[model samples]
Target: MLHCPRKTARTLVYSGIFLATGLAQAFALDPTGDWRVADGVANIRVAECNGSMWGAVAWEKQPGGRDTHNPDVSKQNRPTLGMPILIDMRKKPGVDQWEGQVYNAKDGQFYSSTIKPLSPDQMEIQGCVLGFLCGGETWTRVAGPIPSSPANSMAKGPPKSPGAPPHTAGMTAPKTTGSVGPKTPGQKLATAAHPADPVGDICLLPDIAGFAH
Candidate 1:
């Protein structure tokens, strides 16, 4: 048997702990769930679709709002209820943040944006207009912490991290997960009178489907 020094053993232990801490910081935060926006007018539901993240309006204080400001005339008449606000957010390696485009319905423009989960219940959102950085806003969690699925249904919900946001409303990414089981009859069936599950429904929404992958 070889002799091992006590001091060397202790040093090794400390090194292991430090490495573990660093690795934890490197992985992205799971930003899934319903999150109340800074203005408190609506909640955005966020979830993972394919491989990236997407967020859309889930609830609004004043229903029947329209995306009348959309630059695309054909889309202007669309309702804002389930409209995607955070478009195509992907994880930023080595940090707990996601980078993408955020829609400003007020102006019908998309801005460069980044979302960071400050804590389990809070998130920070910052966007830029024509490369000029704008002010950031904080969002509070409201729902979700659900799961991410191929369809983003509860059946395929993603695993929740003690992180993420700007969601539970729309930036709550990863939205909330487990090994998805076989599909059930209740999964995708929908009609105008009874809509599909909003959490994962955005995955199939026409507005973003063309670009979801």
Candidate 2:
């Protein structure tokens, strides 16, 4: 009968995992790339910097060519381009979302932000002011590389397709005006836009809409 040492078995198991994880990480698709913020106010480009990954804001789409948010701060004399806005938060098991922080160039404020991977090409960024004081907005993915300059972005024309038909908002269809029909999905249940399941309240229906509720 042949007997393997306990320590040797443990070492072999851990070594296998370590090697597999190292290979996985090496081949993992990195999200570090060019991304444009909502409204094109900021264009962020991520690349390897200082032996670590960092992002730099290449161009800012200034409406009036002025930084009204932080006028005192040197818009030009900044140490880094985009600055250290977001940090790698976590990569939890069974979860695909990547958590991070978002630094507001306006008041120099940092907020808890998250980048949810919608698909291979699309991601949603949720950023707020503080403790729900300010509302959060979603950012859609833009095609191609982030514009180098505001002029270049403008020259490309509107963000939407040029030949696309004009959008008509707030146009509602004629109501039947007869009887109150059955409630649809939206009316049937409520869901939290941003939910933090601490205790794990697994409800059948989406009853709680707000985080607190």
Candidate 3:
């Protein structure tokens, strides 16, 4: 029997996985790409940032839509395109579904939500208001399965110093709703008539960069 160090053995296992799958991005929430909403009105870009999952509006067929219904008067003029629709979704332990909050721009409400991938190109998003009036829709994958970003990463940074405390969130995450998001902090939000920049990495957006754990 050949003897191998623990680290070496782990590397061998991961190498085997890469060799077998061509890539190891098949992990459940690897749904980090663009998805077309059921209504076909918009595309949401989902990605994992800071160990949690989040999504934002990447495109809107109608182009100029506002969060007019948003209770936050400050954000009422912000464009719906490129807005963060999915908030702080953390994976449920031992389950494939993720639990978090979803912003319903139509009603300007924050509803409890869960997201699960049904297939390589399909994902299910369920949203509920106050635990009732539950409803869901299947979104068709349009772009990703892409690589995660490092901006708000938890494990990709420099090694912690000896005896250093573990990384912790310096500030609480933005409120589930009534907080400006999907918009870069400090930068003036665009009007509803603004066009979407579907190609951009939303994880770099202010709300996301500041919220990651």
TM-score of each predicted structure versus truth: 0.66, 0.40, 0.67
Candidate 3's C-alpha runs over 4 A off are 1-29, 150-199
**Displacement of the residue 57 alpha carbon in candidate 1, Å:** 0.5
Encode model 3's per-residue lDDT on 164-208: one tens digit a residue: 112225644321111122232211323234343443656556667
Point out where model 2 deviates above 4 Å: 1-30, 47-54, 62-80, 129-131, 140-213
Clashing pairs in 3: 84-182
In model 1, which runs have C-alpha deviations exceeding 4 angstroms?
1-28, 150-200
**Scored by CA lDDT, what does every candidate get?**
0.67, 0.39, 0.68
Worst 10-residue stretch by lDDT in candidate 3? 174-183
Candidate that would win on lDDT: 3
TM-score of 3: 0.67
Tens-place lDDT per residue, model 1, 1-213, is: 775699789999999999998766543345766678999998887766666777888778888999999989999898998899999888898777899999999999999999988876688989998779687899987554435443334332344332221223433233222222222232222123235334345555555555764
Best by TM-score: 3
Per-prediction backbone clash count: 27, 2, 1
Q: Any residue pairs clashing in model 2, and if so which?
A: 56-82, 57-82
Candidate numbers sorted by lDDT from highest down? 3, 1, 2
